[model samples]
Target: MAESGAPTQRESMADRIYQALKEDIFEFRLIPGDKFSESDIAQRLSASRTPVREALYRLEREGYVDVLFRSGWQIRQLDFKQIEELYDLRITLERAAMHKICRLDKPPPALRLLNDIWNPDAPSERAFGSTVRALDESFHCELVAAADNDEMTQVHQRITDRLRIVRRLDFTRPDRIDATYREHAEILQALIANNPGEAAEKMTAHIRTSQEAVKGISLERIREVSQQHRRREPGRP
Candidate 1:
């Protein structure tokens, strides 16, 4: 009853749209502060407005977009305040998760997942940054998953999505990339040794250090974009 090669509708139009939009945002194809209309996205993706709307809603919840009044969606702007809040939450949750993982007689599948993503021979800063971001996220997720705590894992998954944006900025910074990889390797060693206290300390320190690095970077670009938006508005006092 279907065309031989056509994708099934049950494949879920909303999911398809979500994946496309998520990738675009993650890869910076849809840069922060870029505005897009739901109607335009629907037409461009050949998707129903329903699916596009659903995808946009999900993106908004994920901190990738914001719904604008009397206009379309605007990509969510990254800021120091959000970055600090995210890292603080991450440090708390990840520290707890690592402690629990270290106490287990045999750590769960998550440890293996983290090990698999480790690469000592990453070629460039860009590649190293990307690798570090992926491995760092996987490491935290695995720790939560290993703890068998569903609520904490869900909380961390949400945190990870927001952290991705920060990681993107941090990883691309030339001075931070090598230091990050070194820190990650140290953390992994502690986790492998089942030293919960050390692991927790290292993770917390790593996050704090990274947060400081982000804060140190000038937000001139973000400020410039903000000014541009303000100027475009009709009547600003």
Candidate 2:
């Protein structure tokens, strides 16, 4: 039911809050398990509580945050199990994309776009990581487009969106960023050579190695955060 004077579909406010929160979370400005208050966000953004609440609801639905019983909202923590699932899903979709890329006689524009962003001469780790992340996303998207599977692409995109925060965290580590670029080069070479099997293998290995490297972070830290958020009441000291 439309409100007496409200528009049927409001576009911008929810999106503004979404983008703002997403950037903060991805850049680690909002640490995992950090508590958030709807009132605080609403005040800071100079928006009504309704839109801020809407944004928080959407974030929670997307697995980026969890709504505690009495507490406000908490950023979701990363876990090995979720990381493993992300890699497994990527392997499946990426292999399909590799096959499609190899079958084509000429490279698609998407592949070219990926190559441009992944240039090896990038100066800073932050810039390099940003490029790599973009390229990584473009590669998978190109694969889906090449396969001409809209439904699967949507599904993959949804999963990727859920993993964005963790992926950003993984890439921010200096050593991981370097290793990621090296792996990207190898993967690109395999794609250029039209070796679907080799490309898939390299992609899978890259994801696995990255996951293994970050496995050392204490899951206890994540658990502690989750517990704290769960216990804290909204507006409490």
Clashing pairs in 1: none
Candidate 1 regions with alpha-carbon error over 4 angstroms: 1-9, 112-129, 172-178, 216-237
Q: Return the number of clashes found in candidate 2.
A: 0
Please provide, for model 2 over 49-82, each residue's C-alpha lDDT reduced to its tens digit, 9 standing for 90 to 100.
Answer: 8988888889888778898887788988776687
Error of 1 at 135 (Å): 2.8
TM-score of 2: 0.70
For all predicted structures, in order, the TM-scores are 0.75, 0.70
List residue ranges in candidate 2 displaced over 4 A.
1-11, 104-106, 113-146, 169-182, 219-237
